[model samples]
Target: MRSALIVWGGWNGHDPEECAAIYRRWLHEDGYSVRVETDLQVFADPAIHELSLIIPIYTMSKIDKEPLANLVKAIESGVGLAGHHGGMSDAFRDAVDYQFVVGGQWVAHPGNIIDYTVDVTKPEDPIMQGIPASFPYTSEQYYMHMDPSVEVLATTTFSGQHAAWTKGVVMPVVWKRLYGAGKVFHSTLGHQAKEFENPQMATILRRGINWAARAEA
Candidate 1:
């Protein structure tokens, strides 16, 4: 059976613990053996190298350098990495290697949280096929520092919420990247547990997990 190691917990302000639980339940129901943990050191376990996927439900936490390094190595050797919003992107701010592998960093959500529309740029991708080309949701409108290597699959344009100079900006909301021998998928949604209950989001996330586990090149 495929295994997923979920590491959840960090600033409660981000509600990662609750979000992690939501994912644990989702994956369990989907028939994957899932192990949930709050610590970051599990990356050091040689056994972690055997897992098919690793989900980081952690946001803005200081990770031990050793384990962080080990995680990079593990994924480099072929382990899928997947997560959404701050839980994945905001986990290790000071670790360049972490950001290097993950492919982006959260910068700001200019007008705080607001309703926005997501446009699927890659409708043929399995994760996006059933999803409508455009949909509206009330959540954080993320401004990210994206990597050039990532294939952006979805984007959201700033909806004129503020009279700032950046009003017409469009940013990636979901993307995928091949890092070393592993795969990485990130969606800038899922700021709250309620968001995960969206059928579209659930299907997108499920496909992302499967995509990340694909055989390495």
Candidate 2:
């Protein structure tokens, strides 16, 4: 059976535990055997490489060197990685190595929380099929520094209503990339667990996770 590990903890404001539960339920529904962990040490285990997928819900925490190394190694060994929002991009503030594997780093949300639109630039992509070209959304509009190598699936344009200088800037909302032999998927949606209640956000995320879980351990 395909298995997945969810290591969730860190800033509680993002509702890491709550978000983890959501992922756990979704993975279970998809027939994946899911394991949940609150400790970062789980990443240090060599057995991590035996799983088919890893979903990180940690936010604003520092991971130790040994565990970070092993985590990277597990992904490079063909284990899949998928995550959303700050849980993945903003999870490790100081670890550039983690960012390297994930393919992007969270910089700012220009406007803390506001109404925005998610434009599906690649609606034809499997992860995005059936989602509209654009839809109304309300959350943090993430402005990230992304790797050029990532395949962007969706994006949002800053109206500059909150930050004037960013008025017309287009920012990536969802993307996928390769890390060594691993498949990496990410979305900037879901400020908290509640956002998953939105069908569009939830559908994109679900398909992204399933798509990224292509490689077997």
Candidate 3:
């Protein structure tokens, strides 16, 4: 049986606990033996290397050097990593190593909590296979600084209403990349657990997690 770890704790404003529950349910339904943790120390635990995937719902928090290094090493050794929104990209703001593993960092969210559209960039990709070409969404439109080599599966266009200079700019919303032998998947959706109620958002994330698991890789 495949094992997965979900470490969730950090800004509670993102509802980490609730998001963790959702992820746990999904992992269970998918037949993974899921373990959840609320501390960053789990990153340092050697057990991480034995897991098939790691899902972090931690946002805007500090992770110690030793733990961060071990986490990176585990992933590089073939463990998968996956998460959405700030929980993944916005965590460990100062850690370049974490950013390298995640493939992107959340820099800004113009017009916070507003309506926007998500455009499927690679519908043929398994993570986005049945998702619509474009779907209306209501949440923060993330403005991220991303790794150039990551494969983008979905994107969103800024209207320039909030940041005029950003108007006409397209940004990646969902992406997957390889970190050594690991498969990393992320989506700049789900500002909170509620967003998961959206079928498209939920479906895309579910598929992304499955795609990122070590078994799939």
Candidate 4:
């Protein structure tokens, strides 16, 4: 069976533990031998190099050099990485290298917990297959600083209702990219575990995880 590691714990505001549980369940259902950890120290374990995927639910957390280096090295050597919202995008704000690996960093949420629409931009991509062309969602529509190289899968338009200057701006809602031999998947949704209860949001996240896991083998 494929193996995966879920490292969760950082800002409780994101309900990392709850989110990790949800991911653990789905990963197991998908036939992975899943391991869950609250401590970041596990990133340095020799076994990290053998995992098929890494799911990090850590938000706004600090990481020391040793473990962070190990995590990065593992991904670059073909381990897949997947995450969502502040838990991933906004994690390790002080670590620019981490942000680079993620392909984007969460900067702001203009209308925090407001209604918005996510427009699918790459319906043909397997990660987005079967999802609707567009859907309305209620959450923080993330405003991110993105890496230009990422393959964008979905986007949201800023109505400028909350931030006037952002009116009519289109921002990526979901994306996938590569860091060396590894596949990296990210979505700017899921402020909390409840967001995944939305069928569309949950499907997208699950599909993204599957896509990332296959990047290596």
Candidate 5:
């Protein structure tokens, strides 16, 4: 069976433990052998190199050089990496290498738990199949500094309602990229675990995880 590692813990606001549980259940249902950890030390374990996927739910946490290097090397060696929201993008604020792998970083959420719409820009992509072309969400509308090489699957437009300078600016909501041989996937949704209850968000997240885990195979 395919193995997956979910390393969670950082800021409690993101409910790292709760979010990890939700994904753990889903990964189990998908026939994966899921190993869950709250410590970053797991990244240094030799077995980490054998996993098929890595899901980092940590938010705004510090990672030591040894473990962070191991994690980076593993991903570069083709193990998949996938995450969402501040957990992945906003993690390890001082670590440029981490942000480089993620392809984006959460800079601001202008409205902060307000209503916004996500536009599906690539409905033909398998990760977005069956999701509506557009959908409404009442959450943090993330304004991220993204890497241009990512394959954007979904996007959102800023109304400048909260931040006038950003009005009419289109931002990527969901994207996938490659870090070395690893597949990297990210979504700016899921401020909380409950947000996954939305069918569209849930579908895209699951598909993204599956796609990332498969890597180039």
Candidate 6:
């Protein structure tokens, strides 16, 4: 059986613990041996080396270098990595090396706390396959610092609320990237637990995990 290691908890405001529970249950139903941890040491375990995937639900903290490096090496060797919102993007903000390896960093959400539409850019991708072509929801409209090579699967257009260089910009909301032999999938929409509970959102998450974990095949 494929194993999954979920490291959660950094900023409680994003409800990483709650998000971990939701993911744990979903993945368990899918038949993965899952473990939820708040400690970064979980990354260093040789057992983790055999796992099929690693999902980080952490936001904004420096994970100790040794273990963090261990995880990076694991990902580089083809273990799957997947996450959403600031949990993955804002995580390890001070660790430039980690950010570089992860492929993107959360810079700003220009039009904060507003309703916006999320459009599927590559609807044919496995992650977006079952989702509606377009959908609307009330949440933060993210403006990210992204990697140019990312395969954009979904995006949200921003009609800026206040004057800034990003005013009237169309930005990627969800994307995937290949890091060495591994795969990384990210979504900027999971700022709240309710967001993940959306039917389309859940389906996308499931498919994304499967796609990211595809290397095991």
* TM-score winner: 3
Model 5 lDDT per residue over 1-217, tens place: 8889999999999889999998899899998999999999889887787888999999998999989999999899889999889999999999998888999999999869999999999999999988999999988999999899999999999999999999999999999998998999999999998898998888999989989995322
**How would you encode candidate 3's per-residue C-alpha lDDT over 36-139 as one tens digit per residue?**
99989989999899899999999998999999999999999999999999999999999999999999999999889999999999999888888999999999
In angstroms, how far off is 39's CA in candidate 5? 0.5
Evaluated at residue 88, the lDDT of candidate 2 is: 95
- Tens-place lDDT per residue, model 1, 104-210, is 99988877778789999999988799799999877888889989889999999985666376688888999999889888999988888888878877788878877
How many backbone overlaps does candidate 5 show?
0
After the best TM-score superposition of candidate 2, give how far the Cα of residue 87 lies from its true spot, in angstroms: 0.6
Instruction: List where candidate 5 sits over 4 angstroms from the true fold.
Output: 215-217
Question: Which stretches in model 3 have alpha-carbon errors above 4 Å?
Answer: none
Model 1: residues with Cα > 4 Å off, grouped in runs: 214-217
lDDT of 6 at 116: 83
After superposition on all CA atoms, how large is the RMSD of candidate 2? 0.9
* Whole-model lDDT per candidate: 0.85, 0.92, 0.94, 0.92, 0.92, 0.81
Question: What are the per-residue Cα lDDT tens digits for candidate 6 across 1-217?
Answer: 8778899988887889999998898789888888889998888776666678889999997788788888888888888899888888889888887776667888887556788889999978767886889998677777778788988998887765543666668788888888888888888877888788777767777778767874442
TM-score of each: 0.94, 0.98, 0.98, 0.97, 0.97, 0.94
TM accuracy, model 3: 0.98
lDDT of 2 by residue, 85-168 (tens): 999999888998899999889989876999999999998899999999999999999999989999999999999988899989
**What is the TM-score of candidate 4?**
0.97
Better of 3 and 4 by TM-score: 3
lDDT of 4 at 48: 90
Better-scoring candidate (TM-score), 3 or 5 = 3
Clashing pairs in 2: none
